[model samples]
Target: MRWSSWVLFAAGIATGANAASLTQVTENFGPNPRNVGFYIYVPDKLAVNPPILVNPHWCHGNAQVCYTGSQFATLASQYGFIVIYPDSPNTADKCWDVSSNATLKHDAAR
Candidate 1:
């Protein structure tokens, strides 16, 4: 649950965002991935020509208002780049061969 802990720590940051839409997109990149939990937010304006970015761990979906992400997201768009945040899978710790984090459960792809 380290990722969730970090998300909780950064909860204060994504409080006052300027964007309009947040989306959780899931695509079957390959037949091998039954569920590749990933998430992204496209600013309200990027409904059509928005950019796509690849970053890890920004929003934990528990934050009511993502204050920390607002400015950074805005800046990324200002620089002609769209920002993307990836949700860590329940198996992030698997690389260490450690016990699973029971709380690290994923909901259906929204």
Candidate 2:
């Protein structure tokens, strides 16, 4: 999808971010050239420069939903860290781009 389309989609999801103690944030890393967007879950309270966890989704799945369903969020809340869920370049599959080095680099570099 185009960058503008992704921005719209990200904005749509971000509407509900402030609903609770756990806030969800959307960030676009398209400037890196692959047009990747990510969802980050941050606890209402955090320590100084908390650590981060990068969670990737499986094929044709949702990364934020997965992270939300896992124990990671709970741990992050308790431990005061950040959890990031990056969307695949191909959202259709939602799979980590393990196809090639360049693809993998794109995923890692973001």
> Candidate 1: where is the Cα deviation over 4 Å?
1-20, 27-34, 44-51, 58-70, 91-110
1-110 in candidate 1: lDDT tens per residue? Answer: 36343332222122226343344444333331234354444444433443445555433332113424456566654554455555444454412212344324443232
Global Cα lDDT for candidate 1: 0.41
TM-score of each: 0.39, 0.63
TM-score attained by model 1: 0.39
Cα deviation of 57, candidate 2, in Å: 1.0
In candidate 1, where is summed lDDT lowest over 10 consecutive residues? 7-16
* Tens digits of per-residue lDDT for model 2, 2-53: 6445434443444355521333444542454665656666665555766767
Residue 93 local lDDT, model 2: 70
Top model number, lDDT: 2
Which residues of candidate 2, in runs, are more than 4 Å off?
1-30, 104-110
In order, the Cα lDDT scores of the candidates are 0.41, 0.61
lDDT of 2: 0.61
Best by TM-score: 2
